[model samples]
Target: MTADRGVSTVVGYVLNLGIALLLVTGLLITTSGFVADQRHRAVEEGLGVVASHLAGDLATIDRLASTSDAEHVAVRADVPEQVAGRAYTIHVSPDGNTTKIQLVETRTGVTVTRSVHTSLTVSESTRGGGSLRFVYDDDGSIEVADD
Candidate 1:
């Protein structure tokens, strides 16, 4: 009777330890996936805000170039060098009636596009993100380039 009593207690302890380890492993795996999803969401929102700001800046420069008598207009855009811990690219392209300002992150390939309403013609160009200069030339053309 005494031997049988000790056997059941030892078996119970071993079973409990195994169950606890399994539960902890499962929790770690699930939380890792959740963390990755949250990181991706943050990256998307950050890119979107940057794209919108650039588009607004482009529109402002266009208005000034079209209405003012300035021969060469260069407006410095205050933009971040990196988005979500990664460098990005800025692309300006014509999309039908509106011009599209698209930002693409370097490693992640996350892209966000914003449209600007401008009468002045925007040249299709791709430039690295960071300090930027929007130039309105004497010939009535607007271009974006690295500052």
Candidate 2:
């Protein structure tokens, strides 16, 4: 009887250990998922900032178009003053009909382009997580939908 009791005790302990391990594993997985989500959010926010800057520049180009007579206008935006540790390039091409703005992130391999008469398109490819492409249409609004 004592031996049976001892065996049962051991079995109980083993079962408890297994339960603990399973809980730990679940917690680890949950934590990992949370961290990944945070990183993705950060990257997305960075992209948002880049998009905003390009949109503002585009708006400026539209305004300039109304007043300026230049048929082909090109502006090289100064690297954004904020978002240190990241590098970006803004290219603007103004033609007789429409203006094209391209924003490229040197570090992330993300390209966002917008045309005066069309929607904004963004494409990103990276190791942490590969490409994301979306379009934002013009309607006095910010729209981000999968493409």
Query: Each candidate: what lDDT?
Result: 0.87, 0.50
lDDT of 2 by residue, 42-116 (tens): 654665566565556545544544456555333333334333344555554544455565655565465666656
TM-score against native, each model:
0.85, 0.45
Model 2 misplaced stretches (Cα beyond 4 Å): 58-96, 100-113, 116-147
Model 1 ranges with Cα > 4 A deviation: 1-14
lDDT of 1 by residue, 1-147 (tens): 999999999999999999999999999999999987886788889989988888888988988999999998888888998877778888899766689999888576688988988898888999888899889999878888888
By summed lDDT, which 10 consecutive residues of candidate 1 come out lowest?
104-113
The per-residue C-alpha lDDT of model 1 at residue 112 equals 90
Number of clashes in model 1? 0
RMSD of each: 2.2, 11.0
Candidate 1 displacement at residue 9 in angstroms: 6.3
